[model samples]
Target: MSTQTPTVRGDAYLIVDDHALIREGIVRVFSDTRPQARLFEACNLQQAIQTLQGEHGPSIDTVLLDLNLPDSRGLETLQRIKAVAPDIVVGVVSGTDDDHLAMQCLQQGAAAFVPKHGELDQFVQGISAMACGGIYFPRELLWQVTGRLSAADAPPMVPGVASVRLTQRQGEVLRLLLKGLSNQVISNELGISPETVKLHVSALLRAHKVSSRVHLILACASPHAA
Candidate 1:
């Protein structure tokens, strides 16, 4: 039930975890990176929902949530956060490192899925991606999923294909994506609107025959991919 009121002008972050240590660690890292950023803390799903519904809710730009809260578990935690603050970026920071769970989080609208075992730098990267309206998965998870898909001997259209066609702008978008830029960042980089960037991203995914941005990046990383 404790919170740190953020300033009116900078980005606000909500850290939803029952563990005091985890919350403090995230707060410390985020403060190091974004000194002026606002932070809020919650112990469980109910507290989190309450904070999101409170006066500071609209100011929250991102939410770093732990999946295994005392009152909520698994994807339901993410779904509830999205239900209350659909526009706010939500990133999962779970102790579990399973790729299946990571994929599920992505499918369920998480902007990032980071395992608790990862280093702080990697965690920060995930947060950064989510903050900018982009999706991020751990590199190990990405490689694992890519390998699994590769082992399936996927159809030629699914990532390992030669020369998936792309418009000049799509190519620009792809290049930025490879660099791990989010839609908002890509839009700023390409001088296009975020909605336009989303369209190009969707086109890239379609061209690669993959469903998510993480998969699109994986496809682009393949040797046979363009």
Candidate 2:
């Protein structure tokens, strides 16, 4: 990623990649996928900061950021962006093909993460998922990452939160929730009914003392939870 970026501006959807061609391609895809979205462009971390913190006041809904920016690298780029505007959603688009990087990005507050070499459909899916308050990791990458985790590696109980007493099914539901799975998606994954998934979600909300799935994600991601 280049350390120098042209002084550019954008709104609605922000595309932050060092290469102009990559940003142009993103704008082209979003033109069809989200026609209503106003596209913004930034070449590096510095320009991205200016665009995001400009007069619009977080007017941009989602940021598609390249991890290896001129001034930042990997998860550090995400941290800097969030620092500029904490509430703005961000999706990582990088050349790297590491599933663990995707997981780490998600846990660290990215709304989504996808490889730049992935098909255009994956990019579309990632943006769409984030727009709906869901997190996106390429399904294959997600499966591979989760598959590598054993029971011994599972998060331990939180001292004050009774998230520990969760039943096997409840635990299953929480794992999917942390993965940013929707209720219907969770049902499909677990071979359970949608209503059952809803019940489990409600139970998890109560157990975690968090009212929303997003909050549950934070609780799970935080050091205090483990």
- Local distance difference test, each candidate: 0.73, 0.71
Residue pairs with backbone overlap in model 1: none
Tens digit of lDDT per residue, candidate 2, span 151-170?
Answer: 55555343247545667788
Model 1: lDDT to the true structure: 0.73
Off by over 4 Å in 1: 1-10, 131-134, 144-164, 167-179, 183-226
Residue runs of model 2 more than 4 Å from their true location after superposition? 1-11, 131-133, 144-202, 208-226
Clashing pairs in 2: none
Whole-structure CA lDDT of model 2: 0.71
Q: Let me know the TM-score candidate 1 reaches against the reference structure.
A: 0.68
